[model samples]
Target: MKDLGLIPEGYKILVTATVQEEDCDGLCWQYIHNEDKIKPEFVVSTEPTDGGIYRGHRGRMEIRVDVKGISCHGSAPERGDNAIYKMADILKDVEALNANGCEDKDAIKGLVKMLDPKFNPNHYEDARFLGRGTCTVSQIFFTSPSRCAVADSCSISIDRRMTAGETWESCLKEIEDLPACKKHGAKVSMYLYDRPAWTGLVYETECYFPTWINRETAGHVQAVADAHKALYGDKRIGSETAMNLRNRPLIDKWTFSTNGVAIQGRYGIPCVGFGPGAESQAHAPNEIIWKQDLVTCAAVYALVPSMYKGKGDEDVCQFRAGGTDTTSDKSAC
Candidate 1:
């Protein structure tokens, strides 16, 4: 759309893409800000949404548990230590932690809200909208001397999701203090991300994505909601579930993470989300988007930059007066 002059002429925009950021556990934007040194007023994330304004999401991190053992020939298993055995016990403890609760008193508060469906909890008083925190074992591996030798080292990867009130240090501490870890002398640590971008720039950071939420009345949020209202007025493909109508309240949260993890979660910058596809379609088989959704989203995208710069009443009146382009031009709608 920007290639076709859809973005307003006076406005400036910067687009970036990341590498090795699969699973939505990303940190490219932070690198761009601190390393590449490109900072903007705010960010607009088009991550898969059910066509609603996504204000916030839970944070996530990658954790590692290392178990060490002595290697011995396979012929005599009793002669050497088997790291896999220790890992098995640690895995069981990890499962218990997921099913049960952690020792941290405050972490339990966030975990319960995330595990139970009755009520979503938030730590931030002004922006009270986020689900619970969670943890799970994602990957495991072990090292052996040879096909006939006993395994000497084993490691497991954890995918920990954080809701309000949870921090990277607290989450790591919770795992380090697990009974099995203490019994086996397992080492717990967070992974460091230092992959080179497609541009060959390597920006290293801890793999901790913080949790954040924004109020509905925030200026960026209001700009997106107002732009949609001015363009479509509750008329679009799909129902309220597929579309966020101007007639309804402008508030919702994504259960999954997005670039917002870096854009707003870490930097405290304001971020708003308005995208075409539904959240379920992401990484799903036969993912598809409605044709009309593209057109509608394009129109709204063009209007947001200009509308954001205008006074509330003046922009609404101008839009209602048809002094804007609905498609790809500077002409009036």
Candidate 2:
């Protein structure tokens, strides 16, 4: 495309590979850049998913709830307060929060307004597109004097999946304000991820990854859709028969998080996903990628940068005017 004068002159593409990505806990981008200083204007993650255009995915974070109490011998349980019982109360509220049954659900907290096809109490348009925020108890532990003693301290780890219009701070504050949490004096906080990379460099980062979605009418998505149509010519792949039948646009979102958590979720860089293999194949037995998926993906990736006429940089867009393409001719973008 560049040799054929399709690529603009000032643009350049830099691809990268990383080590310990699987164990980095989403620090692959941070490790590579901190080690080598690789910056970018935007990111396109070709993370494994059955070949399709993914505009965004739900964000996620790690939450820790610490409950404190007094310990006692198992024979004399009445002598001390049980932290595990307090944790059980907090857990009930957490479950009710996920189910949207809390009394203060009318508050501006983002979760209650969730709008899934199966459950939409408020009819929020954004939730209709991105689904709802979610939370669940992922891990639990208690500090006990002995195996037969009452627990003095207990902590539960919560995995929170954030939807649009939600933030890490808000989620934490919401949990802190829960009736059971306040009653139990539970300390709600976001976890910090500080693990050493294979390179032995330890970088500490918060666990909050924000949510993102590219509007279907946005220029970047339009460019990608144009490239897909140009290369694939309206041919459907995989299990897209329903989309084909309904005549809906082929854009999608990942069910699982990707490096897009850092690229777009944290940095606010424009991003979209297209890749080979199914998400089900990710981290599963007998993972595989088809040869044609790679070829098709490469063609689409190469075509997007040229098709993308970004904002505030129109001087480099040298297109053949009055021939076929006629999207824009405005100056001073």
Candidate 3:
């Protein structure tokens, strides 16, 4: 388009090929925003949206729970305070927290509470639109002197997905308030990322990815939607093999998280999504992207910057989840 002199005047399109998104979602954007200080009027995440215009999706966090115990000979199991056994109790609570309902009388109100007005008074409607949050124990580890000895310490990694109205603090507190966790004096904390990128630069940051949603009528969002309608009609277009699956509303949300977690969720920048490929192929073994989807996305993207009506000072964020007290330190970068 630039070669053909089609790009609009006074508008520059920047394509950022960021790093470390797979290791830590949005970490690269945190660096871009904090270090590079390149704040655009809006961001269009190129994450696969399956031929739809994605406004937002639930965010996620990596949490760690640690429990302490004294190791003793396995032969005298009663003499040792088994950390794994205690973790087992806490695991059951985590399971219940995920499996319970949103009833007032339920012992453990599940994440579905986010979808209810009573529990999520401020953002229940947005929560209902994006879907409820969820938590699950993804990994476990322990330390012991030997296989014949009782474990001295146990830890677990919890994958917590956050919907609207959920914050990192609230998510941690929910686990800290769990009956077994409190009884066992479990430590709940968000994980930190300090690993070096391929460029050998480290950008240290917490692992909390904030949830964000854009109003369906927001200017940037409408720009993408209108471009799609004008270019491919109002319905999602795909190759013959992908048409059956792409037969959903043109406007939708991602089932997974995206860099918008930092671009908009953290900094309140207007963000939208329109990209090639399907969400289902993300981590699957036989991942593939249709050649036609690529061309379709490219043409839509080329038209968006021209179609966007400049935004006003009024906030465009429909709902943005709160971040933790932690801030990214990009000194090394």
Candidate 4:
């Protein structure tokens, strides 16, 4: 467009290619926003949206639970406190927390409680739209003096997906309040990321990614939807091989996370998603994207900036999860 003189004179387009997103989602953007001091009026995420205008997605976090015990000879296991046994109790409760219903009669109120107006008063509807939150024990580890002795410690890593009305503090508190966790005095905490980017820059932060949702009628969101309508008609456009999976609503939300976690979820900057490829193809063995999707997305993206009538004050954000109390002040290279 620059060479063809197609860009409007008053409009400026900045393309940022970030790094280390796979290691720690949105950490690069946090650096760009805080260290580089570059904040765009709005951001358009190019994550695979399966040919739809995407406004939001559930965020995620990493949680760790640790339990301590005493080790003794395997022959006399009864003499020692078994960490794995204690962890078994907590693990059962964790499974029930994920599998139980939100009804008052249920022994454990699952994360589905976020979808109930009685529990999530402020954002239950949005929670329903984004779907319920979930928690699963993704990894487990244990340690002992030797294989012949009782385990002295056990730990688990929880993969937590957050819907609207869920926050880092609240999620941690939920685990702390669990009957087994309280009984065994389990230590629950959020994981931290301090890995180096390809550029050798380390931006440390908590693993909490905030959930964000934008109003479907928000200016930035509408701009992409309108642009698609004008360029590709009222439905998703894709190659013959891809059309079968693209038959959903023209406007939707991503089932996966994206850089929008920080752009919109953390800083309140307006963000929307429209990109090539299908969500199912992500990380698949024979991942593929159609050539036709590339052209369609490019044409729509070019027209969106002009169609956007600028931001509005109609509460563009439906819900943005709150941040943690501690802030990382580490300097990046």
Q: What are the Cα lDDT values of the candidates?
A: 0.68, 0.68, 0.88, 0.87
Query: Please, what is the TM-score per model?
Result: 0.78, 0.79, 0.95, 0.94
Question: Residue 199: error of model 4 in Å?
Answer: 2.4
For 1-333, candidate 4 gives per-residue lDDT tens digits of 576564677878888888878778888889999998989888999999989999999999999999999999999999999999999999999998898998979877999998999998877888898999999999999999998999999999999998887877778988998999999999999999988877787778999888888889999999999999988888987888888888999998988888888888888888999988999999999999888888988888888877888786687877776456423221000
- Per-residue lDDT of 230-302 in model 3, one digit per residue for the tens? 8989999989888877889899899899888889888877899999999999999989999999999989988
TM-score, prediction 2? 0.79
Model 2 lDDT vs. the true structure? 0.68
Error of 4 at 305 (Å): 1.7
lDDT of 1 by residue, 1-333 (tens): 576775677768766656565733546676676777876766778776666776778778889999999999999999999999998988877776666643455332334544343332323331235655678898999899798999999999999887665567767887888778888899999988777767786777778776667766667777788788898764334544555432334457787888777766665567778777777777889987766667777787777886675333321110000101122111111
Q: Write the per-residue lDDT of candidate 2 for residues 1-333, one digit (tens) a residue.
A: 667666778988777665554543346775555566666766677886566677877777889999999999999999999999999998988887787642454332336555533334332455556677888999999999899999999999998887655556667887999888989899999888777766776788777665666656566666777788888865435444223332334677777777766655544456677787667777878876667777878888889888876744322111111101212121111
For candidate 4, the 10 contiguous residues with the lowest summed lDDT are 324-333
Clashing pairs in 4: none
Clashing residue pairs in candidate 1 are 114-132, 324-333
Of 2 and 3, the candidate ahead on TM-score is 3
